[model samples]
Target: MSIVRYLTHPQVQIDPDVPVPQWGLSPIGRARTEALAQASWLARTTQVISSGERKAIETAEIIAIRLGIMIEIREAMHENDRSATGFLKPAEFEQVADQFFAEPHLSVRGWERAIDAQARIVREAEAVLARNRPGDILFVGHGGVGTLLFCHTAGCPIDRVHDQPAGGGNLFAFARDGRQVVHGWRRMEEVAA
Candidate 1:
């Protein structure tokens, strides 16, 4: 089967003083990247692509290093732009995050319109799929936007995806045969150690 795996880097860091995109994964997050690299699936991944973000780059690098391959960075693959809001202390962002998910069609507290971000993610993702013929492909990205892309590709409404499951920090698999076919999805926690 032509499989594409979408993986969000494990708990990267957020720089409260800086923008989210610029931040790299924390030490623990780095370990998680390494762990992900050890998965049997890594051997089957012919190519790895990632968001230009440091965390995604780091995560992709881990797999690349193990496989003796290189990571391709794509700006379109980046997490939805969160430049408008600086770092949100956990307590603060949490309260408003629900509202964003609750109203997928609206912007989350003016951060980025959920609908617009999802559209861009879908566009870029389709572009990636176009490049590869039918092998295992890995894309390292973020949680929220990743979910949206997966939802859209699966023909599921973006807003309702949240109700189905929490998809961030996970590996989501899809098959393409002139159409999107969801293979499987698993949160990091659910992955067998």
Candidate 2:
């Protein structure tokens, strides 16, 4: 059966001055993505989908290039919107993210509610899957929404407990036919294994 993998971009440049979505991947992130691009398992990836955000685009571009495929950008697959507060310090961002997941129904600090994000990501994934394309699919995007998607696919409630690890470059896989999760939050480098 074909599979779908959602990969969160790795470490970013982390500029507080830049809008979060505009921040590109850091050197480490790029290197890790390049390495993942060569994974044998990705040989079957016919469609590479990504969020419009810069970092995610960068990540998708690397793999799509290696797979000899063009990427399809889905803006609705973007991370839980946090533009309301702009950039926050690492500690502060963590606290707010915690609350964001903890209270899925409530919008924390003007951010998009977790429930809303979950629905949007799920809807976007379903739209693509409805096409019933051949070969595996790769979705390059953010950790927050990736986690939200994972939770939904795994039949779990919205919670940060399922969040990807820090520094990103994590991935999870699910069966496209039944939308059932095959794995959860493996580091990108280890996906081939």
Candidate 3:
């Protein structure tokens, strides 16, 4: 079965001063990504794609090196546009996320509406799927947008998006042709360290 696996780049070096897009994974993040490459499931992957973001690109690069495959950059796999609100301190950001999830479509305090991000994610991922042919297709992207996109693609209720953690550890696996989810969602945390 053809599988589309949505992977989120692991722990990033959080910098509130820079745009999130420009920030890359921390050393620990790189370690996590490398660990992912060594996972048994990854042995079957034949193709790879990544968001052009630094962290996502870094993750994809690790996978490409291990799998000996070229990494295709897809704009659709990019993180949600958080440019309107450049950066927030951790506690402050958590509060914002709490509000954002409550009314996902409406803008609250300058964050991009989750609905808009979700729509773009769905569109971009669909386009990516059109290019795949059997084996396994790996997509490396940021967390928020990846979760939103995966929910859209899987026909899951947006409210149940939390059924899968909203972190880099989450992976969404789906059958390419039938769009049937072979696996609903799995956490990297479940993989042995």
lDDT of each: 0.74, 0.92, 0.76
RMSD of 2: 0.8
Clashing pairs for predicted structure model 1, backbone only: none
lDDT of 1 by residue, 3-92 (tens): 777888877666677678888888888877777778776677787889888888988898899988888888877776656666778777
Tell how far residue 24 is off in model 3, in angstroms: 1.1
Which portions of model 1 miss their true places by more than 4 Å?
160-168, 178-184, 189-193
Error of 3 at 68 (Å): 0.3
> Model 2, 167: alpha-carbon shift in Å?
1.1
- 65-156 in candidate 3: lDDT tens per residue? 99888999986667767677778887887777766666777886877788887888888778877766667888888667776766676676
What's the CA error at residue 8 for candidate 3, in Å? Answer: 0.6
- Between candidates 2 and 3, the one scoring higher on lDDT is 2
Clashes (backbone N, CA, C under 3 Å), per candidate, total: 0, 0, 0
| C-alpha RMSD for every candidate | 2.6, 0.8, 2.4
What ranking of all candidate models by TM-score puts the best one first? 2, 3, 1
In model 2, pairs of residues that clash are none
